[model samples]
Target: MQPDVPTASCCGEADAYFADEIHVRDGKTYAIITDDRPDEPRGRPHVDIGTEIEVPDHKLKWDKGNPTGHGIIFLSRNRYVFCYVQPGGA
Candidate 1:
């Protein structure tokens, strides 16, 4: 997590949100799009690789090997949800 990442919320939440738009660059999960809002500048919109993410119901190992980007929403460390966003749209 860089110092200039934007913060986001799902619909309406109080906790801080951390997002990383990763792509397979030389077989590495590189942070191409980040949102650290209120602390860092928002990055430009870009298309991510991956299929639609289903809302997670339990804690699972986040596989970064996938070339597609996945969006996840979690309630603390227990309840978790996953989804996918099209680059720049909320």
Candidate 2:
């Protein structure tokens, strides 16, 4: 989905999240990734398009209690990637 909503997370208020492809529409699967860490500031985090990453299973937490079943992918002690799973999804 193309999320035009601005979020406090990610790059703060400077830019809105979901400007790039996050999850494929064909399936529920999404690529786990880390910040690309550019040599210079780009105002927002960047991820390599085809670079899929792997983290501990425990880090991927799914919140079934939420209406959207939103989950959090904890990448590090202070970094995390929020997964917004749409309703009616597995």
Candidate 3:
């Protein structure tokens, strides 16, 4: 499924973290990657859109403790994975 958001990136915070698109959206999935920079901005963080996240079913780490069950995993280091389950990561 295509992303509802029009644009797909907002990581232009002047020499900010290095964000790269490992895989472009193939009509379903794309990856917005970033490095583990020590100077990552905590406030007013950069945003990325028009990106696709591929969360393999096996990649998920279920707590198996919570009633609703949660997945605590990330596909990148740029902190781009700060939201809920990525596009095609189910």
Top model number, TM-score:
2
What is candidate 3's local distance difference test score?
Answer: 0.34
Q: Please report, in order, the local distance difference test score of every candidate based on alpha carbons.
A: 0.30, 0.32, 0.34
For residues 1-90, what per-residue lDDT tens digits would candidate 2 score against the true structure? 212223423223212122122354444445433333351353544444344433323322233322333222322223344333222244
Give all TM-scores, in the order shown: 0.24, 0.30, 0.25
Clashes of 3: 5
TM-score of 2: 0.30
lDDT string, candidate 3, 1-90, tens digits: 112232543223332333244443544433453434443553334445433456333332222222222222232355444222222233
Tens digits of per-residue lDDT, candidate 1, 1-90, equal 111122433322332133444344444332332433442232222223332223322222242212323332222323233222222322
Model 2 regions lying over 4 Å from their true place? 1-42, 65-90
In candidate 1, stretches whose alpha carbon ends up further than 4 angstroms from where it belongs are 1-10, 23-76, 82-86
As for lDDT, the candidate ahead, 1 or 3, is 3
In candidate 1, position 5 carries an lDDT of: 21
Best by lDDT: 3
What TM-score does model 3 achieve against the real structure? 0.25
- Model 1 TM-score, 2 decimals: 0.24
